[model samples]
Target chain A: MLRALRVASPLAVVALWQLASSLGVLDPSTLASPAQLARTAWELTRSGELPHAVAVSARRAALGFALGAAVAIAAGTVVGLSRVGDAVLDPLMQMLRMLPLFGLVPLFIIWFGIQEEPKIYLVALAVVVPLYLNLVAALRGVDRDLVEVARVLRLRRAEAVRHVYLPAVLPGVLVGLRQALGLAWITLIVAEQVNAGAGLGFLVNNARDFLLTDVIVVGLLCYAALGLVTDGVVRALEWRALRWRDGGETA
Target chain B: MTGTDLTTPVVAAAHGVRRAFGDHVVLDGVDLEIRRGEFVTLLGRSGSGKSTLLRIVGGLDQGAEGDVRTGTAPAVVFQDPRLLPWRRVLDNVALGLRGPDARARSTEVLDEVGLAGRERAWPRQLSGGQRQRVALARALVREPDLLLLDEPFSALDALTRISAQQLVRRLVDVHRPAVLMVTHDVEEALLLVDRVVLVDDGRIALDEEVGVRRPRRRDDPDLVRWRTRLLGLLGVADA
Candidate 1:
């Protein structure tokens, strides 16, 4: 069955890898054995190095994401609602969206210096465009008839947004959040690992200099864990927001 | 039906209304009015500008060159229910109106529409007929002096349409909001409205009052005769 193979294949690969390490076919310094990586991870956890690095990375990602998402949502709402706002902000966003954001790492380093500022700004820049684009597209796709219904009811400006536009654009906003969060992690990795700083990426950089293969693998695993956790949080928010799609009153 | 006459206050009126999409005209210098407590239906073929004129009178169309006046914003029940899928029945019904009693009034309207226990239900959970009922409830909750129903029941099944029609008839009688419904169904036009106007060539081809009383059967002699006349006016030769 596919279910069993899905579980067994990864285990088989790990077993083969450990066997190769024991037989000395693989260099322990170049690529750590599964047992060795696990041992180093345990040691780092006890010594508090891994935990401290994770905390620092989490703080940077959270701050950058919060800043980016807030500004993007506000800009998107303005452009989507008013024609005047659309005229000014929409063209600017269209041009900005095409910027190869990851390629700005060097420029960011120059402007913000090789510190938390560069890393955080890199993450922030990477996230803003996609969320803004998705929110604007969602607003454009709202049903014309629904808009007419609002006009017929003569809803006030604020009331129309609350009753019509907010819920209409929510699914798109949530989708954009997931995408932006993934890109945030990838950008953080690039920014931190390439430059001087403290974080998971710094840990990876330090391990490479010392040739500690086990520590490097542990740092990579930490990145994967943080990414999954952030994505899971967004998914939970999505379920709560769109409960009207399937779940009933009792549910 | 409630003694509508020339002296009754007009809830909505449009004079010399003209609208065109580039070279093609949809409504051509049409004039119409709905008196207080009266139900009027515009019967027309597809693309005959019936819906366009309704939209113009309801303030949804601004391209028309005309003098249009109406009381407070008309409550509209569009062909598609147009319920907010994310909003619960209660929230949807309470959409425009404000104040603390909004929810309580919305609940009362929902109950009147036979959706008494569905306040917390999402629009997606309801059947087509139930959703239309919620749309009606939403319109009625506003307590507008003018009500617009744009083919509101046309999308329902035959049996469901009959019940929906009856519900509209019942509500109009109770609330007495000046009503204008657009429908191609001749029988529906005759069965529901105090006056029936036939639209042809982007203009009102025929407008007449129905003398038939309420609680009348579909097979009643007067409605049958009116149905034949209206269908003929709508360009159906053999009815």
Candidate 2:
């Protein structure tokens, strides 16, 4: 009940703002009441423009996040397992990770020419560092005693990895994915604003130029809604994947 | 017994086993022979390297020196139950088994350990004693010729420890694995082992045989005598 109230409180505030604006107590042109934003969002949805923009942004974010996470996890595992791999790649990765994704926008635009390639590359760059760091830490945190038990059982290297290491590192990987998802969305918005021909970010940018507060409000709300939806999907998948983890009880 | 074959000794010999971690020598030229169906407890103080020796015997560690020649691979139970948290009780028990027979073997072992109805229970849901029983089941599932127990019941409460010890005794009687348990508890050592080996300064100081019969009472005169001797050998003043 408390959780539901907390969620409803924000919407209630928006409703109150709309009512106050409709009563002429507040300027709708400056603030753009919730009702106005809703009407604008409905029109955009009916015209299929909003849906197309959302589809493009979602595809770009999903593809970039998946590719980045996969590569980072593989690289992190190699770096964690071998001393040579760690020594050779650790310093280089640390340097690259320190470089901000937005700071590389100009170079990305120059290289990829303001196309979808640059925007996707920006999203990947934003996500890879956190995923890599989390995966490496997780791999290092694998229990030595568990490995010893596997050795005593005479488990083959592959069997040990499958039965022990994978399960042990899963929680850490999920944490990274959660963090990466949020960053991917934020990066997608920024990349779209700068280079995207179509997206929620492009819509918001277009509204700003025309002083269309309703469109701007609608775009921002859609971004928040998209973030919530993606996070929900990831969390649901995490719960399903780690069902053996104390029956989905949060630790 | 139908499956009893007592002609050959289970663990052949431990010849001049010397283990050292850098400057500190844990086991120094230790030689011992464990015969089939013998409950030999290695009693020592903390850091006396009895656990280290047990690890070497269990094939979990390689000694700095010496060779352990055995008839078959041993199954070990650590002080911690070491059950995989993600695995069910039966799956944890089946950890040591191979191929398709693992599930049936695990169920049988769980039944033998008096946990017949707890095959689907998770490790976290089990009590300390029950977890150790699962660990025992895991070892027994392999049908190992030698069972190496590294203070398996030490972490449990007194009541739980006693019951677990009794369970181990029953399992040993039925399966007849050559058992070597390392423990710091002298009374627990006296209660469980057929022969007690006192280790001090990285060497076996005393190897005494218990003449008392099965289900021996703690207050037995024979046990009292052996305990006194063991305490003296361990440099503990008699109470």
Candidate 3:
């Protein structure tokens, strides 16, 4: 019953929205109706424009996320594991994260040009903050008792990290992964806007010139879809990695 | 396990050991020794430095004020079990344990602890008693000369505690490692250990030999008398 209500609530809203559009209570130019948006989306998909934009956006997001996550994990581990590293690096990391990163898009374009470099860098910077913070917090929260166990086991530093630290950090890392993926999409949207070139942002920008509200709506929906898809992927990963997390012990 | 006689070689020894966390000293000038194939329990209240002493002896803590040495890096079973939740029962048991036979030995120890077929289970999937058993197996799989236990049974319920105790006692008999267990339970001390070292005011207040025969009863008069003495020493009314 609850699941049905959950599904029905969103459906009811869409139904109401479409009704408003059909009755001409809403203007398509002002705000495209759901049906018009769907038509535009289908037309764009058939012309291969939507697929090309999605591919371009995905490549940027994936590359930036990959680069950002690698650096964050490495730095988070260093700062998490060593006091000197924490003292030296954590404040620096926090400072970098605290900056209004999006505001730097102008400077980034000037420095790296309004090329792929600036956009990818913007997305990477956006992805870095969330993953790094979550990872550090998770590492700090590791069971010290298990570290003692690692010591007693006579595991080498690397072995201890592999068996103890890595697994312990996984849940937090997955949480970060979800956040970073979401941010990567948001960052890419703003990034591709500056370039006014190939990507979902370009499609939306191009539609605005011709007042193609339905096509712009389609682009917006694509961005939201990208966010949901990445989140779903991370959620699936979390489900697998944390299957051993406490639910209830066998009696 | 029935502990061996005093003639056996000492597996671990500590002298004038001291530990302080910032301003507070936990273990002060504490000296203790455990013979091979012996079972010793450090009897102390919370904050009495029994665990601090154990950590020092187990090589988990460093920068102590005095000498502490063990024949080999000791195996420890903490109250929390400390099994990696990500590792299955068998992997946890085999962790950091080297040799081509490590996996087989881990299986044997799991069976010895009565967890024969549950090797594939995750640590979080086990009950508290079962998890503690896995921790014990993890320690025993190493075949260390010294086993350090930090209140290993304090987490279990009454009935499960008894079973876990029996399992430990049986494993000690089979493996014959020198065991140093820290606990506040006087009855537990009397039931399992060959000697009880009372820790008080950050020192060894008393190191009395139990000298009781194997399979001691909880209500045994000798044990009762010692419990009363210990309770009094711990400043209990013993009413």
What DockQ does each candidate score versus the true complex, computed on alpha carbons?
Answer: 0.60, 0.37, 0.55
Clash list (residue pairs), candidate 3: B1-B169
Residue pairs in collision within model 2: none
List candidate 1 stretches off by more than 4 Å: A1-12, A19-25, A82-91, A247-251
Could you tell me the lDDT of residue B93 within candidate 1?
Answer: 92
Best-to-worst TM-score order = 2, 1, 3
| Candidate 2 docking band | acceptable
User: Mind giving the per-residue lDDT tens digits that candidate 2 earns over B96-200?
Assistant: 467888899889989988899888877888888998999899888888788999989889999999889989988998898889999988889888888888889
lDDT of 3 by residue, B1-239 (tens): 34456688889999988899999998888888888888899988888888888888887788788998975858888888878888888999999988999999999989989999999888877889999999899888888899988999999999999999988988898888889999988888888988888899898899877877767898788788888999999988676
Model 1 chain B, poorest ten-residue lDDT window? B230-239
Worst 10 residues of 2 chain B by lDDT: B1-10
Task: Report the C-alpha lDDT of model 1 over A90-147, residue by residue, as the tens digit.
Answer: 9988888888887788888789888788888878877888899899889987877788
Q: What's the lDDT for all of these models?
A: 0.88, 0.83, 0.87
Ranking, DockQ, top scorer first: 1, 3, 2
Better TM-score candidate (1, 3): 1
Q: Name the runs in model 3 displaced over 4 angstroms.
A: A1-27, A31-36, A246-251, B1-7, B16-30, B202-205
Question: Which residue pairs does candidate 1 place in steric collision?
Answer: none
